[model samples]
Target: MEHSGKNKTNGFLLMLTLLSVIAVVAAPFVWDRFMEGQTGMIALIVVEVLLVIFIIASSHSLWKNSGSGEWKLKSDKKGMRVYTLKNPGETWLKIKIIGRLKARLASILTLMRNPDAADDVGMFDSYYIDGWDPDKDGVDPKLVYYTFKQKLFPPFKHREFVVKSEFSQDPVTKEMKFNFVAAPDKLPFNKRYHRVTEMHNRWKYTPLENGEVEYEFIYDAVDPGGNFPYALANWLIPAMLPFAFAKMPKILDKEKYRNAKMDYVQEVGEPAEAMA
Candidate 1:
């Protein structure tokens, strides 16, 4: 439920911005009544001062909150850490953070927000390479992302997020977390970071306590295969998203017995010999 400093700040600012606009638009209405009046002049000055004061106060808050909540991606030299990790089974990238309270809160927000939209099948996620700090800023391991392969990745950069699940006798709750999108100007590191658009869904098949094979759903997004490479790849993997959704359930149920265990088939060699 916690939001990143970046997201919370922006969300807060968005509300402020909207209100400012409303004030500006309504200024004329006020002017119509009070134009040329002493009262109008006093009111106008007060409003202008209040707006300026609000902006200044917010900027100051942002500066104090600005260390890492989301304004920009800082490199190690700037005290931010970086890292990248890949396993045959799992591919993830992460960043580390030291001791900024607000920064830590922002970090929490990021962890929760990433994989922003992964379902039982797949998700959309993003993060910097674990160790490639352009500015030497510390990175949080939790600030890692995944790769999703498709003919064409979405035009925008994805996000970071997480999900937690609970089970019960007859009812259970599934919880998910998310963070705010990075403002275009706030992404401090690389534009593409030499990465390409990518996405994927984790397929799982597990036998339930009831002798049925139930599955756990998970998803992630990654950067890989540029337009040219994807073109050559023949759009094969990317095109499967729809099919992934449609057939995932069927794939788990392909066999009539979700939990049927196999014993053994008749021995072909011995049986054939016996028949002969």
Candidate 2:
């Protein structure tokens, strides 16, 4: 997704800072190795150059798409309501590129090396209920098991839930959609004290006239009595959403459905793939 305006500028600055730190850390060792005529000196130099080029290219791409996705709060009744808008102007080619990048980054090796690995549900999380057909799936949706992590303080926190989903169609738009409403069963820690007591993560996909698809993701959640007690979590959740949303188009672009293929095995007793 493209990030423009102030957000894009901020992201550029952050990427620059990160690259600088990486260069600083590697300079001394690289210089010494070059001076000592290390066996792999030529290879090392080539790799270093390639790494810098990659960083530059990736940063440029990100800077260009900084504002590719947008979010807005629609309501805050029992819970805060938010939705996403994938910049209407974004081209299919750009979307495909972004999706590929996401898939590559979410690959096994990358997740294993990620410091914030615990903060991801990764590829293993998927759910489907028996006898559940979307068209016939009425108001009462079936329970779905999934794992997700919440960014809390230093170390990340994880939450596993057996959430029930509800299905409905938009009256005006006739958009088919489903929403997670309750976590009938939750991890022990979350059972007693959890920021998300009630949640409605609604996903709606619309087929466009141009043969492309548009997606609208809505996240509505209640923090029962304000367990977080901070305005930051509310804001952060919306900002962090684009990443997950962005991954969907990527999967569709590849014309593959790993989750659908694995759903039966996963439900029958296969252990979920641990994110690194």
Candidate 3:
């Protein structure tokens, strides 16, 4: 877990590094050209589209194969890595519960992060879980809610459980969301849910210097005891501040609270202690 936290901090730093380069080196060129052609309606559209793509690519889970199996995540580092456990034949894998950790992972936000303003598939502030499926021939412990949610049943083919929940509230957008996507169309399964019953908590140590750390206690909501959703939440999650600030004018001194140090979080590491 200690090493995992370090990895997350590293990955976030890498992401921030990538964005800073984009801003300091790339933005001026693009902005200059954009302003010159600002009067052209299509040019403005093109620039906006480019910016949106740039933001999404920075803040969401795009996939690649890792080791023996496929991994779906924006970064394979801790605090921001997602893992979806697959069925291993007759052997059932025992997964440690880290829902709280997963939430902490995605909850950390940085000033460098730009909110995803281009996701038309679904819209929300935090993690977005869009798909799910159960009893798909090889799944170890099948999920009942997804099984029923995707049903073609004779009235008596199912059972229901009473479920309950509290909420994760994002103050900036005044949004209350409770789930994060696990498979995101990149995995074998076709269903999704929040990583757990509770919302993941994130701590932003430095919001001013555009550096920070995050932790998440993600629930394995898709398959209560399964590893897929929990893994996916951690690996794929990214900073939500970028999207939240999409429409607003950039104000480093005033509108930098979310990106500022997260005093509400617990001590995990000194990686983000250098933020200004």
Candidate 4:
């Protein structure tokens, strides 16, 4: 539980780092677009220098977490670094309950992936608004598709992708794996410029000794999108990592909470629903 809180804090820090970087990078562009003629070249140079300083300061402040936990996240200028951690003490009991939780979890994942899914959670500030998913496929077992119309600044752009997906659980190892590969289709944007062109997403849940479970999530892509916003977007997209990683712990917590309540009811020899 203590570790969970620390992991949450790390996630928040990563988000702050990304937001700070975005602000740092976008300010000069925004200023040039709005006040280009008004501001002299010298003034623009000064602003650019100040922007560099701000970026340095903000990035330093946001990524300076020194917490020890089962959750580890590491990112660098090139891209997200490979890090792995496991949540120990997760039992594979209650098959029916676990199955329900998995289904609900998949639904939640669909909501997260589809930026136009009403945005009830408000996960992204600027996201797809139009007919991104005309097929109405929520979360398919064989294939996953997405067509994105995203607006970060003045203009809105479209992004489309299809993934060949597989979801399976191993009874022997008690590991559940979800893997996907980008389809070989002509993308809306250039393959060299787009961020998600050659995308491959791998998600796994492996139960360890002592009733613990280790989660491994790997997201691989050619490019995230075009250079301007997509460059920053390459960093921003992974900010949602902590949120995704935290969900399973939460689901397990719910199961534990429910079982504890049921245990108390059994101890008292009373019907739980009737009591309510």
Q: Write the per-residue lDDT of candidate 2 for residues 1-276, one digit (tens) a residue.
A: 443465666666677758765974686576665554664666667666776777765554554444445453333332223443334333111111111121221232222222233334353333343444433535232233333444344333333334565444343333335465656444344543233555655555443344333445555454323334323554455555555645454443342322223211111122345211
Question: What is the C-alpha RMSD, rounded to one decimal, of candidate 2?
Answer: 17.5
Q: Which 10 residues in a row give candidate 3 its minimum summed lDDT?
A: 142-151
Tens digits of per-residue lDDT for model 4, 68-111? 32444444323224443322222110000011122222333344
TM-score of each: 0.24, 0.38, 0.21, 0.37
Better of 1 and 4 by TM-score: 4
lDDT ranking from best candidate downward: 4, 2, 1, 3
- For each candidate, the alpha-carbon lDDT, in order, equals 0.35, 0.42, 0.32, 0.45
The residue-by-residue lDDT of candidate 1 on 143-195, one tens digit each, is 33333211234653333222221111111111112222222232333444333
Candidate 2 ranges beyond 4 A from true positions: 1-156, 168-174, 185-195, 224-227, 258-276
Minimum summed lDDT over a 10-residue window in model 2 is located at 91-100
**Between candidates 1 and 3, which one is better according to lDDT?**
1
Most TM-score-accurate candidate: 2
Of 2 and 3, which scores higher on lDDT? 2
lDDT of 3 by residue, 1-276 (tens): 975785586577557747754664565457655465536656655655676666554443312211223323332432234333333221211112111111121233222121332132123232212232222454321121121121112432222112221234343322223333332223233234322222222222222222332223333333333233334433333343223333222333333432345322222333334321
lDDT of 2: 0.42
Off by over 4 Å in 3: 1-25, 28-30, 33-37, 40-45, 54-61, 64-95, 98-220, 223-276
lDDT at position 78, candidate 4: 30
